[model samples]
Target: MQQTILEARHIQKQFHDPVTVQVLTDITFSVNKGEFVSVIGKSGCGKSTLLYILSTMDTDYTGELLIDQELMTGQSDAQLAHIRNEKIGFVFQFHYLLNEFTVLRNVMLPGLKLARYSEQEVEHRALERLKMLGIEHLATKEAYRISGGEKQRVAIARALINDPHIIMGDEPTGNLDTKNSEHVFEIFHELAEVHNQTLLIVTHDQGFAERSGRIIEMEDGRIIRH
Candidate 1:
């Protein structure tokens, strides 16, 4: 059966930082299984906040979010963590590879903590992902040893090692140079189009955002258009 990857509706979050700050209000969107969707907006538009909410990393919100028919309204912290590790993959602007671990070990960490796959299984899978991203040659190197583009690729491989149902990336290309940014965007495109992985990316790059299957523009804590 086809899966319903994510459904987000009427989501709102307020930040009481010194004063009352309404970050997101009445934001609604849905991403189908194996779809690639981009959220584009200027800074302070609550794009990252929305991504955080959808990833189940932040539950302090008012809204309805469903993953595979599971409502996320009342899941506890532990339950949410389980759901996140097992179901969602995330990429950040900076490649958050553990500086001390080898590329291969870094990729295998998520699966290890989740215990979703055996150690050997995780190793094999991580190697496979590394190979797919053409960074297998650097798998034995420390995370800090690789080049920027290579590190981003390692980050991508790690994100995929779990075979997540959906991948949420927050400004994944914001730190890379032009060439590296294009390369990273290409990887994201392939992951969604060729590999049929559901992708929800928050990007400030207009060029990159235009390539997504659909673009949702956020403004002033609300979705302005699609």
Candidate 2:
């Protein structure tokens, strides 16, 4: 059997203002190593909310979150930050690139933040990732000089610079055109199949979700299918 890379047990999330609202129900799931999984649901169904919790960014929930056999829930902010920097990669709907920085520098930022490697080593790794993603030619170009698709590819390279075990994306292709979206998906597919990287993507596009190896469908703050 494949090893479980991440697990969520009985996760419950709520919010309170004048009234209490449950954003996520008892969410329990496991993602096997090298698996490409997608979480899909309508807006307000808690897919993104659950993704945030799984990313270890939202600590207000009640549950046990285990990633690579380590219990992450209830960890202190510093500890969680360490985990995020070392083990998890994230891509959002927007490319989130630094427009003023060169593509190479943007990709090197995360590695520098991790402080695990020297500046030269980080730059080397970042350039290698850009090459792998077919964006090395744009490495010296500023973010604003690249096309939208190229910018997204640069973002992916940045996410991979630290070689995180799990890559999580929230609507990563939501801003791309159909062709560009397909290109992004193909890159993710290759990463999972060839590099054995685990991926957890929350997307609204049916074609994108369907092509992923597994789909977890949520509705009304609860998982309805997997």
Candidate 2 lDDT over residue span 109-218, tens digit each? 98999999999999999989998998899989989999999988998998898998799999999999999999999999999999999999999999999999999999
Put down candidate 1 lDDT per residue, 104-184, tens digits, no spaces.
999999989999779999999999999888889998999999898898889888889888989889988988999999998
- The true-versus-predicted C-alpha distance at residue 210 of model 1, in Å, is 0.5
Model 1 lDDT-worst window of ten: 27-36
Give the TM-scores of the predictions, in the order they appear: 0.96, 0.98
TM-score of candidate 2 versus the correct structure, residues matched by position: 0.98
How much does each candidate deviate from the true structure in C-alpha RMSD? 1.3, 0.8
Off by over 4 Å in 2: none
Model 1 regions lying over 4 Å from their true place: none
